[model samples]
Target: MAQQAYMTETDNQGSGHEPRGTRIRRLMSRLANRLFAGGRDGRGIWRRGMVLTALAVLVGLIMLLHAQVPNTIGNSGSLIETFLPWLGVSVPVLLVLALVRRSATALIAVLFPAIVWLNLFGGLLGDKAGTGGDLTVATHNVNADNPDPAGTARDVAASGADVVALEELKTSAVPVYEKALASTYRYHSVQGTVGLWSKYPMTGVRAVDIQLGWTRAMRATVTTPEGQVAVYVAHMPSVRVKMEAGFTARQRDKSADALGEAIADEKLTKVVLLGDLNGTMNDRALNGVTSQMRSTQGAAGSGFGFSWPASFPMARIDQILVKGIEPESSWTLPETGSDHLPVAARVSVDTSS
Candidate 1:
């Protein structure tokens, strides 16, 4: 009778919930204690996961001093720089592993990569584009196998760009693009696999030899109301990645050098270069061109403005670089049937310059 009375009183006081909750809390506490039990010896947080700690530090150093990394080994340095921004992804993975191992050392070491990544790429996360621009130009590498060439042409025309550059043009489909874009662009020129359509009058239209033994580049003077601006359209040789050959870009690099040389010779003060360079400005291989020009995307675009493999853009290979023109804003257009998404930039064109 005494035990029965005590049980009824206990159940009435808290309905037995408090004891169950307390037990669960205690169980969690025990697990935590076991996980963090050792602090001064083997199996301790400081001593565990040293490899992870080392890896984190190494990743940080690589990003911090990526330029120092040599390109001698299969142009490994260039390859790394190509996707350098993605290196930040390793930080979170290392952090998770450190937590699983309860490793304080690794936790601290992960900060190295975290900090390095933030320092390198954090600036790109914010908005830098300004308002107001006189000229809107767009570029696209419409694939040769596009199922709807006419549709692709129409999509590009819809961007309302004063100047449009199309690369990788197929001989048979040139007529389709001409007819589709004819309504929007009155003045246009096609040189080899590349073409330029302009709302303004185009003069000095001719092929630019990029040392490819054929014309894959061209230059024309677009007489915009603001003034005449030299526009260059180019398609650098494509690069391939083979297990044995690594980033086989020797051909592309040579082509880039030739193209850069051509741009450097432009007489016009205001110039706009549009193309699929097959490489990024971060890449040292394009220094011949990048050294002189300014990237509109880097100067005025929001985010990375990646414009390749239209399905999921990852890198900003398509570029709109300017000399003497000021980019007010830059952006990537909606995907068309082409493999590449069109990239456009609005810029302040001062003819007097």
Candidate 2:
């Protein structure tokens, strides 16, 4: 009877230990399964995050490209490109984060804005040695609707620019400009919406067809003390704003191409182009003129001096470009009645060469 009871106790103890071990093994296996599944689910989360990052990068790049188009067709307003160059920096930063995470799509999307930024500002990095000269010329588009043409003219004439180009000349207000500028400019000519007022002798003043009409653009021979320089004053057609047609930049681009061709055929080695281009120097559409001429303000101005809608100027549409002159200084004048403030530059004609 004592042996039987002892054997029964031993069997019970052994059976209890086996069951406990089995239960522990099953629990461990279940935990291992959950951990493995969680890892797989975490990969999906990472993929989704990568997709979102790529979408953001793509949207940023598209915005950057859209901003790059010319404003000649329709003004991009003050909000888009003028205050938006810094927006492009976001793309590369996001791309870096994506790359760190090994996201292929996000890395690919970054290339768009990268190409655009380089296209717009790359040439600016090259060496810009001025070819020295004697005469200084400046240009501006004193808005035709300017309430104070006299004040605007006075400010521009005060710059002491030997030659000044004005565009967007309103026919009714021509007398006002003529009277205010007469004291400084001894010679002047107008063709369509463009005009040239000079302290020097101006000849061969004929209108150049930019396809706007009779004379929105013109070329003149300014016989300065240094030599006869070909000066072109132009105001391409103003782009209109409409809710239906996005940007109408094609017409302006075509006009620019024509003007560029005209300029290229000129025999003179030294050329000066001045007026309200209605487009930024950074715009690739203006490459027609920008490819040949150097912007004075871009070369010597302190910053990205915005010059349109004078109340709160945000982008520089007015410009002075030179082919064979040295720019000493460039700046914008104070507000006038017109929507645009005058932009002036001091360029020395390198006659010594």
Candidate 3:
């Protein structure tokens, strides 16, 4: 009897007793088996399918009308548009879940977001380096408080751009920039804080009134070997989103409207606009400008080149836009001593049109 009791105790310790973690895992396994049992059955498959379909529909809706959503909450629309490329992540995650659930319905639903995401941002996924252009133009917003004006000027001039448009020039640093770039660029024009330095002669220099009380924009005609190109350097009003106010860009919008009107009234055939517009092409607030000209990045660049906060670029506020020109290529330059990185575009003047 004693031997039998001891044997029974040993058996209980060896097999019947389970550690806390093991017990928990076993319970979870049982729960999973219960939940996933007969997963291919009608009700089980339908439930999983419905959940994935809901996810697919949600992603689709955001992709379709993300722009229509108001900026009432931290400029949510612009924020989403800024990081719009990230929306692709949802498709793969939903796909994995559908595969795990083994639901044909969910698997099919995953295709919706995948298709929508591809349609929206697929073009930006490939290499865009194809050919060179006749002219290379660059734009940079040297911060007003930039510590190295000479260095910034040197960096931009070294880019070998025939024309460079600079914005946010401070009163004290303008001379430094002028001296640094004068050796490389023979012709330069400045109006208010915005300036344009060109290797070719400049004409028709004037201040562009963006409804700002002071001058923050200018236009000049750069005479190149190929032909004459009208260039506009503009520094739009800055925008901010705060807890108290959401996407406060009233001033920037007004400035954009004024700039757009000026562009419409422009008599020149070949026109290029460069500056820190303080917004992306995706933002409807810049429709005034976007409606008039084509973004070089969209026309020729490879990916979504976000170029702001020079340390770690998150959104592209600097832009190079053109009308009546073919952009062979567009790209962002290395970071400079400014808050914004320089944006460059190589464009050929189609004088035939």
- Provide the TM-score for each candidate, comma-separated: 0.88, 0.70, 0.82
Tens-digit per-residue lDDT, 253-273, candidate 1: 898898888888899889999
What is the Cα-based lDDT of residue 40 in candidate 1?
57
Clashes of 1: 0
Badly placed stretches (over 4 Å) of model 2 are: 1-52, 59-86, 89-133, 351-353
Sliding window of 10 residues with minimal summed lDDT for model 3:
37-46
Structural RMSD, model 3: 7.8
Against the reference, the lDDT scores of all candidates come to: 0.90, 0.73, 0.86
Q: Pick by TM-score: which candidate is best?
A: 1
Q: List residue ranges in candidate 1 displaced over 4 A.
A: 1-35, 39-41, 351-353
RMSD to true structure for each model, in Å = 4.4, 11.7, 7.8
The better candidate by lDDT, 1 or 2, is 1
Candidate 1 backbone collisions, by pair: none
Best prediction by lDDT: 1
Count clashing residue pairs in model 2.
7
